[model samples]
Target chain A: MMTYKSEDIKKMNSIELLKNLYQLNNATMAELVAQTSFSQSSVRSILKSLENKGILTLQNVDQSSGGSCPGRYTFSKEHFQILSVFVDEGTVDLKLKDILDNTIFHKHIVCSLNEELENIIITITEKYVVNCISIASSGVIQDECFYTDHGEYMTKHEIALNLKKRTTIPIIIENDVNSMMMSIKAKQSCNNLAYIYMSETGIGSAYYVEGNIIKGHQSFSGELGLLPYQNQTINEVIASKSAKEVLEDMFVLILVAVAVTIDPEKIIIAMKKDNNLSLTKIKEGVSKSLSKRYLINLEKSTNPLEDGLDGLHYLGILKLFDLYTDYNREKRNG
Target chain B: MMTYKSEDIKKMNSIELLKNLYQLNNATMAELVAQTSFSQSSVRSILKSLENKGILTLQNVDQSSGGSCPGRYTFSKEHFQILSVFVDEGTVDLKLKDILDNTIFHKHIVCSLNEELENIIITITEKYVVNCISIASSGVIQDECFYTDHGEYMTKHEIALNLKKRTTIPIIIENDVNSMMMSIKAKQSCNNLAYIYMSETGIGSAYYVEGNIIKGHQSFSGELGLLPYQNQTINEVIASKSAKEVLEDMFVLILVAVAVTIDPEKIIIAMKKDNNLSLTKIKEGVSKSLSKRYLINLEKSTNPLEDGLDGLHYLGILKLFDLYTDYNREKRNG
Candidate 1:
């Protein structure tokens, strides 16, 4: 089966053979020739080139089938590590994963908003030789810098520049909600998706159209909290509401807006893990406002934080693959 | 010098040569070779093929460059005509446009919602041999059928099927608001655009993001009239308002919603030609609600009917091009 990682790999024909090998983890020359459309000699040449670049290792696995069993090739596991970080208001979640998306290290650190984020990142980098780093945070990110809703210690670009002084690796900065939506898109096959993050502080939204994120003209497409509902904005109503009836009414109103405006195939609501919000009243209210044909399938996120981290990991893997392809191209051109 | 039509033409190499010939009307072979990237032999071959297909005529022109004079080519004047219809509640506006989008014939007829649309279409089609027919109507269109706010005599599919039985030409059915947005997109270069059509009866919105329309998962996007505001839906408020102050406030509220959510580069408001609505109060209200950073440049449409017709004409041209390309490909393949 083709994964999201393979989807990016298939864009460049030159990398497709190596990408298939990497996805298979361990495959014989005969197996690769059968799997790919490339001729046997082209497959052999690509494998030899990858081996010369130290990207894969070839070894004989068996000799029972013929006079000489085809050798098995495996991608270099030690060279595909990625460091991912998910930053929130007062906490940071760190993860390290391999090319196959296997988590090698996971840790959670509780710190104040004013804590030295650079020091924490530097400490993690000192412990691992990651090919790429990705950070997902809450706010509007532009020009490699993040502008949070409240405030932050340093801009993402500043931190990236600081990290660059110590290590020479690519770093990517993405919005948290955008990251969560990306994770959902990577896992699902739906064309249009609206991921609404409703929490105690505020409500935000991110939309996915045909597997691409809709950031609007200024990257503010899904600022649902600013939507006015019944005399107050959506966030204000959510924050002030203490009665269950009011909350249900507010959810219904917001859902109606999303339904009529976006008409997404699926609506994924991301709330706090401890929050006990029922979908019954929300669905009932939406049904009253919209026809059943326009209704969307509603779902609650099981682990939004994990989803964000997985999304960051996937982004890091893409960056790493891009770097790998660029290096291969430069070597060939030179 | 490349307009949107030229942009579409450049996608297919074969069409680019023919389109350049059409755009230039009559251009010498030397001028064509100098202006286009094709080799002289290639240009001659394309011109020969087009002439053989009865699309263009070649004529000798006097030398202006003080060298050997080359023959000029012009597209056949009578070969490309399109029938366009804009359907409203109690009337239908019909137009016939040539290849250059010049109106050849236009008429506005008083027709009830329950009128037999087929007879009217047949009446017009009998007078002209059109290459394509395009219908733009006020409704949500899906699978060639339109679902209107109120009952109509025939769904768009029924009308299209009826027309197809009479003529073998291609037919396209598009939402009116979507057509308006398409027209705006063709004339402008903005990456993100949101067009809102506000009349005494209802309001509809259409969004253009990165040169594509956002039709949502169920093709129900941009249903702005359903948005609830001030104890009622937007349409109800628009209907109940007799005072100018209330109308201004309502427009401001809707503008603010669009401003913060979509962050569009431009917002076009389409009102009735005689409506005495001013933008000063609407702008002030939006500025008060949203930060200046999120304020969008607002403008009003000068001639909405013309814009809608222009949009339909452009769509019809695209359909005609598709049919032309398909025919050529089938001939070659066979």
Candidate 2:
């Protein structure tokens, strides 16, 4: 959280200019001058400096889209790159990508729980990842270094000694769920949709609205596990060791009681194929218990169970666990 | 929608600069220069221009926080004005406020619906609201003016025509529920929490993360009423007339079903005082139904008799329906 000084901002603007040229592919000096509040001379001067740095290429004047006259401009993609990283307990994935979300190169490595976890992880990153380019990650990486639990393994004194040895690039660390949210934003059809990733051991949710993820203060806003509950909360029921046991108990007691009571828009039961809790069994159990409430004959009489979950049946909810691997990889590496 | 041209973007930046200044509470030229990408000269230039237009003042300046030297700058309050209109089928509430959301003045009017409803509304607005002020409303007010149905008499087309006539200020139209979401944001203790305001008429949800309300695409995302219900849809049961007529239709058929399913953190039930449906009756109804599932003793249990709804018993559901009125004005206007 470096507060911007005047000189720092000027340098940041220069970097932004390089990024914009890379993002736009090509732009005339006049276009930059018009698009930005910067004067024509300032834009020209910046373009010249960028060209000298081998980060841009000047093109001949061309006809404007509809303007009175066309203008010459500079464009380059040489210096355009993003280093994203995804970090989790024992695994870290890092990638370099373009602004278009396309990965240029990527690598995944495992950091075994050793006595020197931090030093080992940092060493691997410095050697295999950061030597030539930038890095991005799934875990919270800040200030061009890994904010890992490395210090826990090594003493606080040793941790500082290890980090000083490597030349770190600009790194953007993101949470796994946030990475998935960004991937969902890449989808063409998804608008105002929330992505809830029910992993093997945890229930995580990412809310997307207007093509951006709803990241709250401290970036821990979507921790649905902490949401209040009676008897037991959603996280306790969904992500705990006694999840199945609790479900079995609630099946007769709370599940049926509440199923007939609080009817949500869609009771999305997000799970994988390996789970013992099948949508079919859940639906069957619900039907038998709440027979008086939901008329089961609706499906047999009118429309058959269509493509999606419908007709009071615990319709097989959106299976997103399959996308978890890609989501994780993209988040850490990109 | 008018695609932002380069010229329009420049104007938007100017407006954003002005808004940011208002948010910062009249910062110095040095503060403005540091907070934004503008150079000292550019900041001075804009400050002078705005002061000339009577929108800013060259107030005394002090040393930058933790900096070596002190500097002078201008403060602007003239442009810190907002003309907000809250429109529903029953009434239109127009208010003028400063950037700090302090209301300068307000007017509430009732109008009859007709084919020319938009014309009537626009005429009233043009007559009352100041020109070139930033305009916002509890309806889709985009591109100076756009028509949208207020779910009652006036068609959106009529509203659009009037908006076309008045294009002085930058207009931002949003859903009434969205406006309520903003109001809720202003009232919340935590920025990451979700708010649900359930009234006799409908249920309004406002999701906040990082202090910004989640506005779904086309601003129609939180149409929670449209979420598919079990056996039926939310709109078919919750907000429909047929269910309301059937005494316990909404509770036994709808509200109870939702309680057992989604299990929201807190569901505030805002209702009218001395209304036909009281919280006591709702709890009694739930207690009777849930007895089969859980051996709940309403007499001995603290759940049902609580001031607000707790666990499965929605006892204090009436607080959700807020009797919204100008409380401050009632004392003054009286």
Candidate 3:
């Protein structure tokens, strides 16, 4: 076990301390001491400090057999707080979550990606209780992780550095498509997958293998939009905001491509509630295209398994933020 | 330290033993004792008995301090072996490798897939000595995991359960594209990647995320060939034999679509060695297509990253077998 001396425990931030407790599986001090990579004495001090703040509660367990005195400990989920913001072309969703991927609070508001975009972001962000923010937009985010007006394309690192000045909490910016991919990848059903998030505005993808998302060179891989469809237009297939275009080209790009390679056990498509008609048309078209392949004798054939996510859901956002934190920690440490 | 008593160990087939050893990182008795979930003494006994046979070796690391006792251990790579067979439409390559991924021996021969396919597979396989055997091909292989084949449209998996009667080595069968994807995904350089492999017959893809290959519903995914290409077909653009069609359609299907969606940090194009002229033409065409999009910028602008693999390397077959075994074990235990 790593020996966390008393002084270190006293100086720890709420985020760090919460992670420590979470690592203990929400167990009490005695249980934590046995399970943790941290030393026993340090766990006791941290537990006491958290309890003093009224952020935790202690419950007594039965006495240990043959022991002179029974053990006691404090526990808390108060440290589990984070703010997640997902920004799209004209909207941003803010959410607060606990470490266990439970939502505390959330709100959504419409906004423009105009010249005053930064100011609008700050104004909207002030409403959330959680300060730990992560943003996913429709453009390329640079290494420092800042967005540009250019859709899904980061201008430079200077913009990211500038954004850092406005926020105290570490802000992680990513592409919206990639975020959804990471979200599905973290879910039990989509454990090993190559995701295709075909939205009305554009197409996005996230590749997951070995329980990790593939962020290619400069964290810019899985740009499925750039992949060619018919007539030299990749977006025409999966990203057309026009329902007719989406219906016309969906099968040629998303479904056929997905069916042929990495035959993912499941494919989850995210879209708005009203787009069911377009989605149905797409499903039929794709099934027809796949069936045309004479050699493909599927043991069973069904509509490419499709699921929808209401982008406004707090549970989904909380899960997204949790995954982002997990992603960041893995990269930073591993 | 699974307290696998001698009886449990005795009950295990060679494949099971190899899988356990691989997961253990081929450790020695002492190291295994410290790491396993099993009892320390049980591990020590298992190591002692296995070492007694020629199955494994325990070597001592010389002490930096002269005259000190040496620390001894075993490396799994030194003890395990794999026989890999790569079958093509008209040829086959048979080889044996140690767990360290070294080829102990190899043989290449021409054979027609249309004639006596099973007999040819058995004949080539008989020449190797190994604990596990994996085969990959270009077509869709059914339930049998004995052999793998690649093709112009979809890949297949077929396993020869009867092979157990011929050799103690476990047999793994998979599609060539999936196998290659697994191989690429396993490489530290290409972890979490969307890779494009263009061979003589067609274009295909394999995706890696979080160190896992994305195997879709039919156990076939990464079918880039089905994604349409303008001017010519996708098959023409990706397959080695369709030089004219590939050259003409390269810009329309590959570069533009790749840039918009699956924005891979590095787009690796696998081609044939002698097809340099066609490759250059395709590059020029793709560059012109990609230059139109500002976001289509790649670190290697004019020259895309490309490598050539042996037509019958069957790299993904070996990897998919390992992944499947791990998945199977996790499934059984869970």
Candidate 4:
């Protein structure tokens, strides 16, 4: 359904093959075939085309493994710089990464998002020859065109589209939780998945069901903090810390909700890199009533921030590939 | 991805085509074409084949007002009898339905489940020549091979498989919540959906993500009542009526859980076809915290039981079509 309409029977397109190869890094043709389920002939032809275009490189693996082995193809193209941006409350975090995923530069600047976005795009793209700009922001992304200031009811900030006008560099923006979830999703496949980020000051959530992300009707699905608990909303309780004693209790409720309703195969609860009583308490409380089947699916992550940043990086790199592939397609058509 | 593998580029199969035609009873070729997204040629070929097999019949339309319209084809095979059984506590509800979904016989029999299952199957089949047996039961159904009484940890009841041995008819079994969900799903397509059935005595939930039911690991999902909630489990609280005043409050939490995580396009709250204090309270509480983006997705249904029965009917009828399809395929191969 990602590339083809669900009803239309379709072949694995070039982007899918590229995505698999990029994730696999240095992998033989056979490995790419297995990862993407493309026929050997199809994989070979695509690999050959990209290799001829200098977008891919092949290196022979040592026959030290039992017998003769096929050559491994690496998807690295270090020339392409991916500019990844994460919009914080009063700051924007920026990172420039190469196709090999090396962080060339990382910066955090305190500024209003609406005012600084245009400047950020110009300043970074000029400095780094950025191939793609991917933003991970916290709000409802309207068809990835604009980020609504507060949920779906607030003033619409046309961040992605406005930035696209500033430069030819492809601009891809998504909800923060969605980006974090996508980062994890890119690492491995989990049919049904829920990613929750909880910390001292903030909470975020993302969901994946079957194959695609569970983006709500208005793309405002992962607004978990807005959910009601007692007289105060979940975000209020978190910010006030008035319900600190029952914070674990509230987390239990949230986990149970996701577990029972979404029925994900795995739910990753990412807390801050540093944590205290919350994780243990949440797990213990959940274990009390949630059956072992669901309890086992609950996992704790200490790298929530890293996951979010990595998500932006992956998004930028892949989007860069999409641009390049489109260009290649145009070239072939011509 | 429903019938075809995600990786496989495949055509609209026979079963899918038949399902549309069956659901769109007395529908024209154009209607089936739209529903299944099959080509005119493909639909015509499949219809012709089934017509040759005497499973389908085409009829002429009046077209009184407009230009001559296409003939409508009906899928009313009166010979097929479907035995739909819903296992209730201290009793079993059985209904014999024809292919056109007409209930020919209905009964409520008091019996111990494990002890009387065999007797019930033998008696029903002997008297009626039932073509298909569909069961809507509570608890975990593992691979549709066995129904575990408690959860995944409980003793396995090889109901479907065992009943299949005693009778040649295809046996279809699903969790009651799933059956209700499938029933709604058959009526219309909602990409992300949650179905909640709330009654004075019991609570059940089912989820649809992307295109399929979220049947968690161990197929022990939709165990909503087991979720942990403030000292007592949800089921315990429901059973004792100890928290009757706060029942709607609890339900709001459940709804929020489903809304935020699954991010369904619609969440159907099916009450027991009666008015009470809960529904209003739930809507109010949810409205208070959830913004218009999500609150609009909440829907009320007074026909939960009907949906479940309809689900079983649809499942049984479609499965019968599958059997006939396989036989036809075999004949062609031979």
Q: lDDT per model, in order? A: 0.71, 0.40, 0.49, 0.71
Q: Lowest-lDDT window of 10 residues in candidate 3 chain B? A: B299-308
* TM-score of each prediction: 0.79, 0.50, 0.59, 0.84
Cα interface RMSD of each candidate = 11.3, 12.0, 11.4, 5.6
Segments of candidate 2 deviating more than 4 angstroms: A1-48, A54-117, A120-167, A180-195, A207-213, A224-334, B1-44, B57-84, B95-107, B112-129, B132-157, B166-172, B181-197, B206-213, B224-334
TM-score of chain A of 3: 0.57
Estimate, for each residue in B1-334, the C-alpha lDDT of model 4 and write its tens digit: 1223332322236667776776666678888888777777867877787777677778777385387767777764654688888775556778888877677888877763474776787798898768888888766777675454554567666777667677777888888777877777777756677888775665788887766778776454566776655666777777776555667777876776666666667778787645454666787777666765445467778876677777888778867776766643564688
Model 2 agreement with the true structure over A1-334: per-residue lDDT tens digits: 1222333333444544543443355677765665565656656766776577554666665754665445554433333344344444466454544433345555656753233545554655554433222222222223433333231241122322344454343222344554554442332334444334455454554445443444433323344443223444445665666656455433332333322222222223233334465445555655544433332211111111110111101000011111211223444576
Candidate numbers, best TM-score first, in rank order: 4, 1, 3, 2
TM-score of chain A of each: 0.78, 0.45, 0.57, 0.84
**What is the C-alpha DockQ of each candidate?**
0.30, 0.08, 0.23, 0.36
- Candidate 2 at B169: error in angstroms? 6.6
Instruction: Tell me which of candidates 1 and 4 scores higher on TM-score.
Output: 4
* Model 2 Cα lDDT, one tens digit per residue, B133-166: 2222334434445344444442343343445555
Candidate ranking (lDDT, best to worst) = 1, 4, 3, 2
DockQ score, prediction 2: 0.08
Model 2 CA lDDT for position A219: 29
The CAPRI classification for model 2 reads as incorrect
Between candidates 1 and 4, name the one with more favorable DockQ. Answer: 4
Which whole-number lDDT from 0 to 100 does residue A32 have in model 4?
82
Candidate number of the best DockQ: 4
